[model samples]
Target: MLTKKNSFSILAIGAVVASSLVLFINSTKKQESALPPARPNIIFIFSDDHTAQAISAYGSKLTKTPNIDRIAKEGAILHTNVVTNSICGPSRATLLTGKYSHLNGYKLNEKVFDVNQPVFPEELQKNGYQTAWVGKMHLGSLPNGFDYLNVLPGQGHYYNPDFINSKNETVRYPGYVTNVVTKLSIDWLNQRDTSKPFFLVVGHKATHREWLPDAPDLGAYDNVNFPLPPTFYDDYTGREAAKDQDMTIDKTMRLKEDLKVHADYEKSGIFNRFTPEQKKPFYDYYENKISKEFDAKKLTGKALVEWKYQRYIKDYLSTARSLDRNIGELLDHLDKSGLAKNTVVIYASDQGFYMGEHGWFDKRFIYEESLKTPFVIRYPGVIKPGTQINELISNIDWAPTLLNLTGTTIPRGVQGESFLPLLTGKKVAWRKEAYYHYYEYPQPHHVYPHFGIRTDRYTLARFYEVKDFWELYDLKNDPQEMHNLYGSKGYEAITADLKAKLKKEIIHYKDDEALKIMESKL
Candidate 1:
């Protein structure tokens, strides 16, 4: 059986067999490596002062937002989602760091954000994500965590607004702010690195103060007269903080500056922000026509207040219409680009606005209208369509939730736990009450700074800084917070329990100023 030719042939055949085995292993390895990562791309659409009352999915009858509602129709809606500060900058700061405003140190809009701090986007960037923010990142300093940024300076104008680019340069983009913001977001999606996952924030300045609609959207709700909220003339009899505030729809909402009386708000400089194309139509309808009619009627007191309410509600809803339309554009873009299947879309606001509740207009209180924010999210595979989560969610929990969504371990020192489980209807342990704090006051709205706690059925708060007063309400009984039960004879035990909870919450958040308020409770 042994021969030189036979031996050589056997050796060659064995070598060929070994080579084939190696090739197959290498091919399998290549295939496995070529698979896409499990992490989903995130599109966070954040709007300024867009209340759930205006969102039709949240059961608003005044206006219908088909596109924004589409997100809820197909995804999940959060009923008790709230913000830590209920203002633009602090809410954003909390969202970025997954921590309280005190931890982030951007407690109020007046402060500059410390860019050196670790943020969620920076963590995402480190983990191979391409992060960007398109519009209205109102934190005072330039954004540092994102790979790219085109943010609006300060509050941002409705038309021809200036955007601060990644290079610390402000560039003016001429268009309605909503449309321009959406365009930039789409443009970024087109140009972003396709191999890596992306996180894009399409921040909108719509439905904010002055409530200027797009030129095309003006007079949208002219036919419908929005009914006044039953509590529109809140006498503030029981709540002292409510009486001390100045953000009323009638008294504080300026006619020349806010309602656009003569279309020449040069002192506010909003009219100058508008070009001729915008000014001409705006003047013809709002100034020349509506103002003339308003003067002809000579309405006073309650009638005048009612007129402002109608005008205010119409313009606000009209601006919201444009916002929803642009949201539609982004949703469609996701669908056509094949990104929707693997991406997560979220719609939320910095905070909720009054929408004429309690005759007030601005945020900066721990009341339900101002404290709560709307949140709707869509994930093709993970979230089943039309899920509603009534579990309480705070803005501070945002970053940890994103990290958890990507299957990453949430970083240390992050205060908020991931709420991803809530989306799945898991019966997981969650917080019982939401803690709130507001520092900005005396300048803009004159609403006193306060810290408080909101439970499932009760709201307990302390209005501090100039005076000290405790407020308590059983939300089940007085859902509008019309009755303050503090110092009442029968509810001392309930008030004591809430105060204990508030102290724990303040310490948990590590807020030094609020700790003093908590100590004073003793």
Candidate 2:
């Protein structure tokens, strides 16, 4: 008995009510699942030649690295390691592209990295992330795809270093390289776009070859006599290939050439320019020591070699101490700015360094000392604090991980897998083994070109060019890698399996250039 007008009005009211209800429900659902505010900023503090064994968080008994240790304490420490190419420039290239050295076209220090290729930073920038790189980007070519860059040219000097800015202008700064680089990094962080997320890379030049510390850190480790590594005096007797090498710390280390120490008679009156007040510290630290050791006893032969090792270790640790302090400053900035809660902090080195292990001082070997890089990451919301992952990860994995964190798609042709699952304690299976190749042969260090595969239980390496030999080791038994079991009686099956795996990896990674080189020599 309702009229037509009344019926129409009633139907309109019902429709309006249903629409309002649906809108409210949709709004609530969106509010609940909005992707947690787009993720936190990322800060990567990368150092040159810093070893995993040098960090206290990694169980180093020799030196204390509280600041570097904080990253592990706050985040996850990757235990099983990866390094595609172990040299400086090549390793860096791998880090940026998630590809091997040959794939990235950066094989050695003498070779230049092509910047036109797609790098990780470029992907981040495309995804609305502000990226900046400060300090020693030791890539052979200048950095590209960064919103801002302040990098040093090859093997940058410790004092008054030259920095290339975004405008491609090379300018010299008048201070210790480490301090200046840190200051620049902090300044960039302060002035970055706060509305958008940022990715900052702070590269430090501490703990490289000919280790030099800042003035304040000069006598830091003087009182501490570092314990000699068990293999500090290894004669390389059983290994003919290792014995013929010229990288021994004792025999190859020099007094005047390598150490840069001289007696009073040999002093070229460089200190004469300084006042007595300025001269006091230098003489007190150097003169007495040089006179007592070099002038009086004339440290040479085995005695001189031991002295060099002691000096090298002390200076290297001292430099690392300064790097730790500066890292604390960056961390403090994040905490004060309320950025710590949402920021991802990562600390890593270009490659591992040898600290008198196997009686050597420099890198460029597929050996354990030179192959294992230090990697630590901290993400407050997504990652659990103090998490440790034992999965094998390579430097190439860094790019894909960063891309995944930013909700960006990783491009094809990159060889690394995203490690975000491992970061969050997710039980996802990753690569069980890692592949490494070193290409700088007959150059510096004279280490032959080699490629190898490292599994959880063993390592198999094949050196080419001059020495066509295969070396295998049970990493569980010989963690120091002292013995070679390539031709041993009991390990034939293990060796064959690892060699087959190595071949698969080489082909999978598309290391065609390496394959061609190796095949031609064979």
Candidate 3:
């Protein structure tokens, strides 16, 4: 009924309206896209010889770690653990590259790592992230790929520690190692490129061997009498291989190896003639009541051994107290700076240490004390608060997970898988088991070099250097790993199956040298 011109005008008007609507929708999308996605600032705090059992959040009754506990309280606590090579240098190398010691070309303490090799920091930097590393990085070679690096040089001294900066210049900083490291980390955080995302690694030299605390913390646990571990006096009977090791707290540890007591030797009227340095060694010899009593009563042999255990626990926990306080300082910094909401905070140790467990102090064996490192992660907004994950994980997985969170691609030849899905509560399938390898052997502590696979239900281990031994523990039944069921009549099938899986893993990792030695021994 309408005229042809009128109908044409109507069609033209409809087209114009449709075009305007499309433009309006496109403009709204552009405004949304212009706003930046909230990328997190990651702060990874690592400690020396901090065992999971020492953390109160992990249900440790020995001491409370309130600051470290903050991370677990706000994020996920990973119960299942990983350590590719348990020694300090190797473990650190594994962390940097997400690869095993062999793959990273840093197998032992003295061995140097290739700086040219790819590391997680480099990848982060490439993706527009500002990276900084402060404190104890025990890798034999100097650090690379970091925008700012202030690291200790070779197990740096506790007092007046020397920190090597990125310019290859070393400067001495006064104060306890832990406190200085935390301060430097906070300084780095304040001065970083705010426009870009940042990744900071704050490494603390705490709770290490020869435990020494700040003067104020010296008397922290002086009043509390620590309860003896159930296996404190274990004879190591039926476990000849483990018994023969030299990691016992009683015999192997030295009094002079850890404590301090008197300020002025001569003024104290005890070893008065000795100089401060000369008297310092003596303080280690006789600080604790048991040690003093042993010396006063002239206790010998077995009686002397009993006295050492009591002294070791008190001093170790005192040092741990100082570590907790320093961590609290850093946590406070994040909160005050308004960074807590957008920061990803993590607290972990290089490897777990023995606190009189199996009557041992050092970590090297595939036992639970050495195998489980404490790991707690807090990613605001992304991770559910107060989450706890018992699934197996490794230090190697750290790199991939961080990369994934930053929306970066994980490179080839990395051994660890991305755990971001687990962190975000996504229902993605993850690894069921973890592999562990310790290469230091026939050396310190005399713990034989070993490799093993650990599953939820069992642990399968092989000690290659000594007797080609095989040890299997039914974790469900023997949580403490008191018994070895490798050749037991009732568990023959179980052992056989684990052995097959172990061999397959070794082959999969392409540890040709290890495989060759294993095959020759077989």
Per-model TM against the reference: 0.93, 0.91, 0.90
Clashes of each: 0, 0, 2
Residue 518 Cα positional deviation in candidate 1, in Å, after optimal superposition = 1.5
lDDT of 3 by residue, 74-179 (tens): 9999887768777788888988999988789888886778898899888888888999999999886676779999999877766667899998899988767788
* lDDT against the true structure, each candidate: 0.89, 0.81, 0.80
- The weakest ten consecutive residues by lDDT in model 3 span 261-270
Candidate 3 is scored at a TM of: 0.90
Ranking by TM-score: 1, 2, 3
Better-scoring candidate (lDDT), 2 or 3: 2
Candidate 3: list runs displaced more than 4 Å: 1-22, 30-36, 260-294, 301-303
lDDT, residue 181, model 3: 95
Q: Which regions of candidate 1 deviate over 4 angstroms?
A: 1-37, 265-268
Best by lDDT: 1
